[model samples]
Target: MAPENQPTTGPSTFIGENYHIWVIKIKAYLKALNLWEVIELGEPVVQPLRVNATLNEIKKYDELVTRSPRALTCRHSSLTNVMFTRIMTCEIAKKAWDKLKEEFEGTSRVKSVRFLALKREFELLKMKDSDSVKEYSSKLMENVNQIRILGETFPDQKVVEKILISLPDKFE
Candidate 1:
């Protein structure tokens, strides 16, 4: 018998909020199943059996074709009813992904505005002299994470510098 009580690694249902985090989690889930390529790149073309096609090539093509539906299913099952309706007719994983991205992540203009706001917040973060280092660092990291979630590049060095500059006078 298979092992019992094992926790599954399925993606959590995608509600309206936290779409960025859900995208990251769902990608991880798809990658674990070797189906990310199907979701990311869409259905692979099935070649007619021909003399020129190597066995490996045929096998790879078959695998992609077979896994495409499974990848779509994974994406479908991860959505809530309200979210599911948005992509109900999507026949491919990539289409479903794009639909969700467009709907929940917002349009490019909206995303650009949000990115700027988060960037500004991240830059303006300051550790108050009276605040404990732990509290201030926690707030700093939270802002950094929000910026990173928006697909911006915020390096650890920047965080370190922010920390150093914001150190209380006693720690200097």
Candidate 2:
């Protein structure tokens, strides 16, 4: 019955890049608002087939069906125009979220390709001679985040070791 409040600062727009990060942020926002179950499990069907259903009871069931979708719409509205258009046709939030996931996140084949590409990038990562320690650290962490999102597990110690190895001899 109450309107869902908008997130004070929504995630970055869903451009061709940044789907992983954007979705993660969006999901967190939705979960915080208690709207994630609808997106993840869909709206539950409230059976109105009772032989003696009261009018108020039917209305209550109707509200339940619409509530999740409305919450999703509020959250989805934060997207950029192009991204909004992509999910505009979805009548409910679950469908919209799924459509976005399929479109940007892709299927297993695409995910595998992306995972391989991230792995390659991680392997080739290096601290350039001209790069500052901060810059190199940021680059390494960015790759680490992407790899993690793609379902790779890299222990903190291993990441630390990799960073140490990547540093120039001057840092030793």
List the candidates' TM-scores in order. 0.84, 0.76
Strongest candidate by TM-score: 1
Looking at model 1, residue 9 earns an lDDT score of 60
Task: Give the per-residue lDDT digits (tens) of candidate 2, residues 101-132.
Answer: 89877898998898899878888988999999
- TM-score between model 1 and native: 0.84
**Which 10-residue span in candidate 1 carries the lowest summed lDDT?**
1-10
Residue pair clashes in candidate 2: none
In candidate 1, position 20 carries an lDDT of 84
Q: Whole-model Cα lDDT per candidate?
A: 0.84, 0.79
Worst 10 residues of 2 by lDDT: 1-10
Query: How many clashes in each structure?
Result: 0, 0
Backbone clashes in model 1, listed as residue pairs: none
